[model samples]
Target: MAEMEAALLEIIKNHAVGLTGPLTRETPVSDLGIDSFAVVEIIYEVEEKLHVEVPFNANENPFGEMKSVGDLIDALQKLAKPA
Candidate 1:
Protein backbone atom coordinates (compact mmCIF):
# COMPACT_ATOMS: atom_id res chain seq x y z
CA MET A 1 0.00 0.00 0.00
CA ALA A 2 2.73 2.36 1.01
CA GLU A 3 4.75 1.49 -2.06
CA MET A 4 1.88 2.17 -4.41
CA GLU A 5 1.21 5.44 -2.63
CA ALA A 6 4.82 6.44 -2.98
CA ALA A 7 4.96 5.47 -6.63
CA LEU A 8 1.88 7.49 -7.46
CA LEU A 9 3.19 10.52 -5.58
CA GLU A 10 6.54 10.20 -7.26
CA ILE A 11 4.97 10.17 -10.72
CA ILE A 12 2.89 13.28 -10.00
CA LYS A 13 5.80 15.06 -8.37
CA ASN A 14 8.12 14.31 -11.24
CA HIS A 15 5.73 16.19 -13.43
CA ALA A 16 4.23 19.68 -13.12
CA VAL A 17 1.94 18.69 -10.22
CA GLY A 18 4.74 19.46 -7.77
CA LEU A 19 4.29 23.14 -8.49
CA THR A 20 0.99 22.93 -6.62
CA GLY A 21 2.06 21.06 -3.48
CA PRO A 22 2.41 17.65 -1.89
CA LEU A 23 -0.53 15.30 -2.29
CA THR A 24 -1.78 11.92 -1.20
CA ARG A 25 -3.86 9.17 -2.82
CA GLU A 26 -6.96 11.01 -1.64
CA THR A 27 -5.96 14.09 -3.60
CA PRO A 28 -8.04 14.45 -6.71
CA VAL A 29 -6.24 15.42 -9.91
CA SER A 30 -9.21 17.63 -10.68
CA ASP A 31 -8.90 19.23 -7.28
CA LEU A 32 -5.24 19.69 -7.99
CA GLY A 33 -6.60 21.99 -10.65
CA ILE A 34 -4.73 20.66 -13.64
CA ASP A 35 -6.15 21.09 -17.11
CA SER A 36 -6.61 18.42 -19.78
CA PHE A 37 -3.20 19.08 -21.32
CA ALA A 38 -1.57 18.59 -17.98
CA VAL A 39 -3.53 15.42 -17.41
CA VAL A 40 -2.27 13.91 -20.66
CA GLU A 41 1.23 15.10 -19.89
CA ILE A 42 1.14 13.44 -16.51
CA ILE A 43 -0.26 10.30 -18.02
CA TYR A 44 2.71 10.16 -20.35
CA GLU A 45 5.03 10.48 -17.42
CA VAL A 46 3.16 7.77 -15.55
CA GLU A 47 3.38 5.45 -18.50
CA GLU A 48 7.12 5.87 -18.65
CA LYS A 49 7.50 5.41 -14.92
CA LEU A 50 5.33 2.33 -14.89
CA HIS A 51 7.12 0.96 -17.94
CA VAL A 52 3.84 0.27 -19.73
CA GLU A 53 2.59 1.56 -23.02
CA VAL A 54 -0.59 3.55 -22.62
CA PRO A 55 -3.23 3.00 -25.24
CA PHE A 56 -4.90 6.04 -26.68
CA ASN A 57 -8.35 5.05 -27.81
CA ALA A 58 -11.81 6.45 -27.44
CA ASN A 59 -13.00 3.33 -25.64
CA GLU A 60 -10.06 3.13 -23.25
CA ASN A 61 -9.79 5.64 -20.47
CA PRO A 62 -6.74 4.78 -18.45
CA PHE A 63 -7.73 6.77 -15.45
CA GLY A 64 -11.33 5.62 -15.72
CA GLU A 65 -12.97 8.59 -14.01
CA MET A 66 -10.95 7.98 -10.88
CA LYS A 67 -11.49 10.27 -7.90
CA SER A 68 -8.57 9.48 -5.64
CA VAL A 69 -4.86 8.79 -5.69
CA GLY A 70 -5.50 5.21 -4.61
CA ASP A 71 -8.01 4.74 -7.38
CA LEU A 72 -5.59 6.08 -9.93
CA ILE A 73 -2.86 3.86 -8.57
CA ASP A 74 -5.10 0.84 -8.73
CA ALA A 75 -5.97 1.59 -12.31
CA LEU A 76 -2.34 2.19 -13.17
CA GLN A 77 -1.35 -0.98 -11.37
CA LYS A 78 -3.70 -2.85 -13.64
CA LEU A 79 -2.18 -1.21 -16.69
CA ALA A 80 1.32 -1.08 -15.29
CA LYS A 81 1.81 -4.79 -16.02
CA PRO A 82 4.03 -7.12 -13.97
CA ALA A 83 7.28 -5.38 -14.74
Candidate 2:
Protein backbone atom coordinates (compact mmCIF):
# COMPACT_ATOMS: atom_id res chain seq x y z
CA MET A 1 0.00 0.00 0.00
CA ALA A 2 1.04 3.61 -0.54
CA GLU A 3 2.08 5.77 2.38
CA MET A 4 -1.13 7.79 2.30
CA GLU A 5 -3.19 4.61 2.14
CA ALA A 6 -1.31 3.12 5.05
CA ALA A 7 -1.76 6.26 7.06
CA LEU A 8 -5.43 6.37 6.21
CA LEU A 9 -5.82 2.73 7.21
CA GLU A 10 -4.17 3.41 10.53
CA ILE A 11 -6.56 6.27 11.19
CA ILE A 12 -9.58 4.15 10.29
CA LYS A 13 -8.36 1.21 12.32
CA ASN A 14 -8.10 3.37 15.40
CA HIS A 15 -11.78 4.21 15.19
CA ALA A 16 -13.05 0.85 14.07
CA VAL A 17 -14.28 -0.39 17.42
CA GLY A 18 -17.08 -2.43 15.93
CA LEU A 19 -14.71 -4.37 13.77
CA THR A 20 -14.07 -7.70 15.40
CA GLY A 21 -11.41 -8.68 12.89
CA PRO A 22 -8.66 -6.98 11.00
CA LEU A 23 -9.32 -3.85 8.98
CA THR A 24 -8.58 -3.74 5.30
CA ARG A 25 -9.48 -1.82 2.18
CA GLU A 26 -12.53 -4.00 1.83
CA THR A 27 -13.78 -3.40 5.35
CA PRO A 28 -17.32 -2.13 5.31
CA VAL A 29 -17.97 1.35 6.67
CA SER A 30 -20.97 0.18 8.69
CA ASP A 31 -18.69 -2.19 10.61
CA LEU A 32 -16.39 0.60 11.74
CA GLY A 33 -18.51 1.72 14.71
CA ILE A 34 -18.63 5.22 13.27
CA ASP A 35 -21.23 7.61 14.64
CA SER A 36 -21.72 11.25 13.74
CA PHE A 37 -19.06 12.39 16.16
CA ALA A 38 -16.66 9.78 14.94
CA VAL A 39 -17.16 11.10 11.44
CA VAL A 40 -16.15 14.60 12.48
CA GLU A 41 -13.21 13.29 14.46
CA ILE A 42 -12.01 11.24 11.54
CA ILE A 43 -12.29 14.19 9.19
CA TYR A 44 -10.37 16.39 11.53
CA GLU A 45 -7.65 13.81 11.99
CA VAL A 46 -7.35 13.34 8.27
CA GLU A 47 -6.93 17.04 7.64
CA GLU A 48 -4.52 17.54 10.51
CA LYS A 49 -2.38 14.47 9.99
CA LEU A 50 -2.53 14.18 6.23
CA HIS A 51 -2.60 17.90 5.51
CA VAL A 52 -5.45 17.27 3.16
CA GLU A 53 -8.68 19.19 3.14
CA VAL A 54 -11.79 17.04 3.21
CA PRO A 55 -14.90 18.93 2.27
CA PHE A 56 -17.65 17.98 4.65
CA ASN A 57 -21.05 19.22 5.78
CA ALA A 58 -22.74 18.21 8.99
CA ASN A 59 -26.10 18.68 7.31
CA GLU A 60 -25.30 16.07 4.69
CA ASN A 61 -23.84 12.61 4.74
CA PRO A 62 -20.93 12.49 2.34
CA PHE A 63 -20.32 8.89 3.20
CA GLY A 64 -23.83 7.70 2.57
CA GLU A 65 -22.81 6.00 -0.68
CA MET A 66 -19.54 4.68 0.62
CA LYS A 67 -19.46 0.97 1.25
CA SER A 68 -15.84 0.15 2.13
CA VAL A 69 -12.73 1.79 3.50
CA GLY A 70 -11.39 1.82 -0.04
CA ASP A 71 -14.25 4.06 -1.09
CA LEU A 72 -13.51 6.43 1.74
CA ILE A 73 -9.85 6.45 0.83
CA ASP A 74 -10.70 7.17 -2.75
CA ALA A 75 -12.89 10.04 -1.71
CA LEU A 76 -10.14 11.46 0.44
CA GLN A 77 -7.65 11.10 -2.37
CA LYS A 78 -9.91 13.01 -4.66
CA LEU A 79 -10.31 15.78 -2.17
CA ALA A 80 -6.59 15.90 -1.54
CA LYS A 81 -5.85 16.62 -5.15
CA PRO A 82 -5.31 20.22 -6.22
CA ALA A 83 -8.28 21.10 -8.29
Candidate 3:
Protein backbone atom coordinates (compact mmCIF):
# COMPACT_ATOMS: atom_id res chain seq x y z
CA MET A 1 0.00 0.00 0.00
CA ALA A 2 2.80 2.38 0.89
CA GLU A 3 4.55 1.61 -2.35
CA MET A 4 1.42 2.25 -4.34
CA GLU A 5 0.81 5.46 -2.46
CA ALA A 6 4.33 6.64 -3.14
CA ALA A 7 4.06 5.83 -6.81
CA LEU A 8 0.74 7.59 -7.02
CA LEU A 9 2.20 10.69 -5.38
CA GLU A 10 5.12 10.70 -7.74
CA ILE A 11 2.81 10.48 -10.72
CA ILE A 12 0.68 13.31 -9.40
CA LYS A 13 3.69 15.44 -8.58
CA ASN A 14 4.78 15.24 -12.15
CA HIS A 15 1.50 16.69 -13.33
CA ALA A 16 1.09 19.19 -10.52
CA VAL A 17 1.96 22.35 -12.39
CA GLY A 18 0.73 24.66 -9.67
CA LEU A 19 2.48 22.98 -6.86
CA THR A 20 5.38 24.97 -5.45
CA GLY A 21 6.34 22.64 -2.64
CA PRO A 22 6.77 18.98 -1.95
CA LEU A 23 3.79 16.83 -2.71
CA THR A 24 2.26 14.95 0.16
CA ARG A 25 -0.88 13.04 1.09
CA GLU A 26 -2.28 16.05 2.93
CA THR A 27 -1.82 18.39 -0.01
CA PRO A 28 -5.07 19.78 -1.27
CA VAL A 29 -6.13 18.84 -4.79
CA SER A 30 -6.80 22.48 -5.57
CA ASP A 31 -3.21 23.23 -4.73
CA LEU A 32 -2.09 20.86 -7.44
CA GLY A 33 -3.73 23.01 -10.10
CA ILE A 34 -4.64 20.03 -12.22
CA ASP A 35 -7.34 20.56 -14.78
CA SER A 36 -9.75 17.99 -16.21
CA PHE A 37 -7.36 17.11 -19.00
CA ALA A 38 -4.58 16.59 -16.52
CA VAL A 39 -6.81 14.30 -14.51
CA VAL A 40 -7.26 12.02 -17.50
CA GLU A 41 -3.56 12.01 -18.13
CA ILE A 42 -2.92 11.20 -14.50
CA ILE A 43 -5.26 8.22 -14.65
CA TYR A 44 -3.55 6.99 -17.74
CA GLU A 45 -0.19 7.32 -16.02
CA VAL A 46 -1.50 5.48 -13.02
CA GLU A 47 -2.63 2.61 -15.20
CA GLU A 48 0.66 2.49 -17.05
CA LYS A 49 3.01 2.97 -14.11
CA LEU A 50 1.14 0.88 -11.59
CA HIS A 51 -0.14 -1.67 -14.07
CA VAL A 52 -3.63 -1.45 -12.62
CA GLU A 53 -6.93 -0.75 -14.29
CA VAL A 54 -9.12 2.04 -12.88
CA PRO A 55 -12.67 1.28 -13.90
CA PHE A 56 -14.43 4.58 -14.44
CA ASN A 57 -16.85 6.06 -16.89
CA ALA A 58 -15.56 8.74 -19.20
CA ASN A 59 -18.76 10.75 -18.77
CA GLU A 60 -18.28 11.00 -15.03
CA ASN A 61 -15.73 12.95 -13.09
CA PRO A 62 -12.95 10.66 -11.96
CA PHE A 63 -11.92 12.76 -9.00
CA GLY A 64 -15.38 12.98 -7.62
CA GLU A 65 -15.51 14.74 -4.23
CA MET A 66 -11.79 14.42 -3.82
CA LYS A 67 -10.42 17.23 -1.66
CA SER A 68 -6.89 16.38 -0.66
CA VAL A 69 -4.24 14.22 -2.23
CA GLY A 70 -5.00 11.63 0.41
CA ASP A 71 -8.56 11.41 -0.84
CA LEU A 72 -7.34 10.98 -4.37
CA ILE A 73 -4.96 8.24 -3.34
CA ASP A 74 -7.61 6.43 -1.34
CA ALA A 75 -10.05 6.62 -4.21
CA LEU A 76 -7.54 5.23 -6.66
CA GLN A 77 -6.55 2.44 -4.32
CA LYS A 78 -10.16 1.41 -3.94
CA LEU A 79 -10.94 1.60 -7.64
CA ALA A 80 -7.79 -0.28 -8.57
CA LYS A 81 -8.58 -3.15 -6.28
CA PRO A 82 -9.81 -6.38 -7.89
CA ALA A 83 -13.41 -7.19 -7.24
Best by lDDT: 3
Model 1, range 17-72, lDDT digits (tens) per residue?
A: 43565677777666666665665776677666766665555356656588866676
TM-score of each: 0.64, 0.85, 0.91
Would you list the clashing residue pairs of candidate 3?
none
Q: After best superposition, candidate 3 residue 7: deviation in angstroms? A: 0.4
**Which prediction has more favorable lDDT, 1 or 3?**
3
Model 2, range 33-81, lDDT digits (tens) per residue?
Answer: 8886886788788888987788767677777788998998887777674
- As a whole number from 0 to 100, the lDDT of residue 2 in candidate 1 is 66
Query: How do all the candidates rank in terms of lDDT, highest first?
Result: 3, 2, 1
Return the top candidate by TM-score: 3
Off by over 4 Å in 1: 1-4, 16-21, 56-59
Alpha carbon lDDT of residue 30, candidate 1?
Answer: 68
State each model's CA lDDT, in order.
0.64, 0.82, 0.89
